[model samples]
Target: MSRTSGATTSPGAALAALAGAQFTVMLATSIVNVALPQIRAGVGLSDSGTTWVVNAYGLAFGALLLAGGRAADLLGRRTVLLAGLALFGVSSVAAGLASSSGILITARAVQGLGAAAIAPAALALVMDLFPPGPGRGRALGVWGAVSGAGGAAGVLLGGVLTQALSWPWIFYAVATGAFLVLAAAAAFVTTTPVRESGRFDVLGTATVTLALTALVWGLTTARRSGWTDPQVLGAFAAAAGMTAAFVLIERRHPNPLLPPRLFAAGRVTAGNVLMALLGSVWIALFFFLPLHQQQVLGSSPLLTGLGQLPLAAANMLGSTLAPRISRRIGATATVTGALLTEAAGLLWLSQISAHGSYLADILGPSILIGLGLSTAFVQLTALSVEGVARQDSGLAGGLVNTTRQVGGAIGLAVLATLAGTVTAHAATHQPHLEALTAGYRAAFGISAAVLAATALLAAALTRRGSTPTAGEPVPAGPASTAARAN
Candidate 1:
């Protein structure tokens, strides 16, 4: 069932177009993670140098997200999306064919820039295409599900390609997916009128991007170089100075990249915080869990990938059911329940021992986390855009996604540092294997705490009420006020 131009397309078709692009972008981001060791070996990279491969992409993507959203609003979304896909595809091929670590890292940075362009544009497009009702709710629900499933699929795909073929095959596979999505988007997506009146906030964009990049890089480097290191301290100082400048710039600029008014509302502030915390927990799980399955459990790459299938399936089911459940219970309650469930699941997962069985110890907790993520994601998307005017929807959507990306990047860096610290401490008294497992446990415990914090934030912040039925507008609230004020 293909959607064609000028045909009355179903909500499912519209969602497929949006979700397919999201899935491809997410898959490209994560599929490289599991194959990092192989890539490092292949390209003869030192441990410090290897970390850059992932950080380069994340830093670029997170920093440019808001600017990308503004660009989508200025230019046509369809045009920007197609351009992003093409850039991503070309970069993927470049990374796959690279013979040196430097070349691959540079290509990955380019891919991040492409992803920054694609993600916010894709989300804004969804809000544009779907009306505010049950149809839009269902579409967003599927969108959330596809995103969770895509993360798991990336791990599986990475493992499969790295084991059966080579690490480069992962990039090759992503490139193929990007091309397919590009074709579908070109055929089905309709063009909208460009906004000639709105001006781009170049100063705001540069300041904010630089500030965030510096902050994240400093935090990440502090893990490896110690908190007292000159480079770490200097980076943090630079970040602080730049952030202050960004605030000043935004206040003065007529067209700001991130409008200060967005943070004035209590609910919007809370929602963004929750999104960031949830993102951090989710990214930590994907990064560390795979390591445990392979290194601690002594499983083959294929078996490790297979072990994650149940979680992926459960995530899909949760996303599919979230809309209906939210209608019955309310969005706030649904999100709260998801956060608690995720926290509990992570806590349970931290109890796994070296002698634990996969099905007995891992599968149950994995399923719980999957359900929690699916439910929270759906609610987050809904709440982020709720009550916003049509014109501000793009900015609202961009903020939600930007929070997630930045949170994920920050979380991964912190957790990696924690893991290293635990491992080093344990190694002073025990074997390497024992130390590694201990580190994994400590990391999971911290992740559980983060999820718990997010749950509390959600409970405190989210407003109580059912979403509007088909063809109805979202009720006015603090979140809506923030969007407009911005």
Candidate 2:
């Protein structure tokens, strides 16, 4: 590590390393999607148990992210990041080697815990390296690109690995990457001074964690049991109660896990809200698109994976171009337009039918949706961290990620349930393929509506934030992070 750089060895190298860490976690998330059946068969998991393997990771990861973010601030980011990587590595190994469903599920939960730690810390460290400036803004493009690539790449890589080798290889490959990232972080990321000023907010932490866990559990459970189920209702009730409790505790506590100031920041608030909508779209697209292709179009797993390449490529392109485009058009307008484009693309996709094929029906919309989502994502990441105290960076990062994951989970469950109902009713009179396509199209229509709503919100909420001048560098300040027209 070099003292001259103020962060670690080389800032670019450190960013790459951190990006790699972020990629590893995001990749792990989707990699399991294609391999779920293989894993289920291999471990003799029941259908519900198989779903648990995925949900268990998401539940723990989404729930603990806030605490993990705060821990990065209280403990050292470098220290916590290293700890997270270590836990992820060990858990991945355990998951890879597990012979029973219970063991794999447990290991995945641990892996999720590790992810909760890594995500916030890595984003904070990126801020630590680049600061709020031209370099930092541009770096966000690369960061977003890596994240976008990770999700799409996971689907492709997961399919390839599962077909060529086995399901366990996905875990093994990621574990190896985790270890490599751990080594890089230790070598390249500098040790920062930990914030030791405040008393720990145990009550606030507990209430918030429990609230989030309950909420995510409730939403996820709704996919299996109907929304009216007693357990689902109870979980929602618990979440609401805990959330209220958390608010009260935060007010009274000397130090809060999430300071009230963040909520007061309009840019931060809007950024998070948009990210949540974006998350919902991301999950729904990934989940339902393949089903439409495979179930309706009779595409194989390999063809389905290949069909996503243009989307993956377009995503990378959108992310790479985001920073430059924002400089010209303003981040706010850029995001709004991009989101509108995505909604249009999704609306086009909603017209899919039994006559549709991959090239005819899927390619254009996939690329358009990819371009819009990736572009919006890059800008949103920058928007979320605007005007925050350096000390609260991890908290902001954690909050953004938490909202996205949790929001996506909730939205997916609702959309899937709705689509399922529509499919069941439609199937009585039509072929199953037509019915399934109708359900998938309904999901796409709903997603488009959500994206349209998001664009309107972005256009409205960001009005109160800073509006950077076009064609000139906006100096880093409390107001620079807000996207504005003109």
Best prediction by TM-score: 1
After superposition, candidate 2 runs with Cα above 4 Å error:
1-6, 44-51, 469-486
Candidate 2 per-residue lDDT, tens place, 321-379, comes to 88889887887788898899899999999999887788889899989988998899888
Q: Which parts of model 1 have CA positions greater than 4 angstroms off?
A: 1-11, 194-197, 260-267, 464-472, 476-486
Quote each prediction's TM-score.
0.93, 0.91
Q: Which candidate is the best by lDDT?
A: 2
Task: Find the 10 residues in a row with the least total lDDT in model 2.
Answer: 477-486
Q: Which residue pairs in model 1 clash with each other?
A: none
What CA RMSD would candidate 2 show?
3.9
Instruction: Write candidate 1's Cα lDDT for 1-486 as tens digits.
Output: 211111114545655777898999888767876787789899987766666777777778878888877777666566677888899999999999989989998999899888888887788778767756787788788888889998899889999999999999999999999998888887777754433426889988898888888888887887789889999899889999999998998888887877655554334566777898898877778878888888888876778777778889989999988888878777678888998998999999988787777886799999999999998898787776666544455666678878888888888888888988899999999888888888999999999988888787787678644445212356567654443343
